[model samples]
Target: MPPTHLRRALAVSATAAALTVPLLGAAPAEPAARVASAAPVVPVVPAVPVVPADVVDDYYADAEGLTGEPLKQALHEIISTDVTTLTYSQVWDALKVTDRDPADPDSVILLYTGLSRDADANGGNVGQWNREHVWPQSHGDFGTSPGPGTDLHHLRPSDVQVNSDRGNKDFDEGGTESPRAPGNYTDADSWEPRDEVKGDIARMALYMAVRWEGGDGFADLEVNDSTGNGSVPYLGRLSTLLDWHAQDPPSAAEEARNATVFEDFQGNRNPFVDHPEWVEEIW
Candidate 1:
């Protein structure tokens, strides 16, 4: 979480944190962010295998079937629940991939410098940096407005250019192939999801999908296109590339941003990043 100053800015609802989806054509100025590769140090825990597409459908089906406050409560439970023996802010911060000031709200810099030491043995990988949406603040999600506790899906750290290119557009098979889409919505220029980041995206999508599965029309943000079509079925349809992205993991800058955001707002760390083994389902 950020320091007091940044938190204050969030309270006013004027900063980016206060808005949900960006307006039409609204995109961050930078394009594909860079990511550096140091040594491929193996994870301490066993790798959480990506769920097969068919299995992913099972999870989706189960999540989709849920409705009403039951879905919302489940989602809130996921996001609001504190990881075992960890505070919410601590878990949230662990997943950040960007560098940010504990006190600044606009400094969500997704690149790494010589100063980063959290993820790398030799300080940090200065090359692996990318802009991560604190909340997959999709510009396409209608009626999005950052306020007290808004739905934050579509969040992930990726090449800045790729994310920029995807600005506010839904992941649809628009002749262009997008790695960001699930099998249903493929675009040529869509995000080519990394292994680690895919899972991260999945987690966010799952949270939203389950939460809004039963919301009223326009209120549903979770499951989308019940039949695996392109349109978001409800307000919380999970993004397709979540599993692949999570496997690839967010850049160091994104991890940092997650940390700062949690510290500033929810006051928790990102448990998934810190303890990758806890993840069971990733598509």
Candidate 2:
């Protein structure tokens, strides 16, 4: 799902339906055995288990009084180091943490469709779910590389058709409600994810921009005011992202996702997801 890759064109009926209002398309279930990720096969945890008081307190404590680009820089220095690297191929396993089914740990939830697929149903199998690059791979031309390619924070399980429907479009206001996924919408050049995940997506983008700061030849991913960042590795619109960060805020689901990523897969937390006010602090 990195920025530059073009999703395969949608089939005619799927396209028309996706471009229409409030489509409640049902996701086909996938077999459980096909999943290859090593994540736990346990049942889903409660939506909001209590987070330990000190688990992430020091993660951003040093940035407490900083603001603007300096704040962004300090936070980046804090989280970007000592990260556990997963191969892009292993994102399947990581999804079990970042995108798991809240009610079923044996499954992963598709972002746009809100459908649960067997965790093994990952990758590009037709009708099966696949890793979606919130920051499209093509724009930065960084495919399957450790930082952008395999970063669990930015990758998510998405319905194949709905992911295809999004097709590298920028996130913005206004568009037809997705026929394939409720709460999601698309139009000429933008995407509107369902309200529940809006803040989740915003925080993910902000996290990517901060975590992969081009220090080690990785793209200095950034969020801007526009879209179609080409080979630039940037996602937009920043103003819209800022608004969504505030408007939707972080839900219990977002908190749980961050906790799982830290306690299980990535080892480093998405600061914004863990602390929403960071968005206001740095931007």
Report lDDT per candidate.
0.33, 0.68
Clashes of 1: 86
Cα lDDT over the full model 1: 0.33
**lDDT of candidate 2 over 126-148, digit per residue (tens):** 77888888888875778887777
* Model 2 stretches astray by more than 4 angstroms: 1-51
Report the Cα RMSD per candidate: 13.0, 10.9
Q: Write the per-residue lDDT of candidate 1 for residues 172-247, one digit (tens) a residue.
A: 2234433322222334423333232344554444444443333233334544422223234332223443434344
Best by TM-score: 2
> What shift in Å separates residue 115 of candidate 1 from its native position after superposition?
16
Question: In model 1, which range of ten residues has the least summed lDDT?
Answer: 20-29
**Which residues of candidate 1, in runs, are more than 4 Å off?**
1-5, 8-75, 78-141, 147-164, 167-190, 194-196, 210-218, 223-246, 249-256, 268-271, 274-283
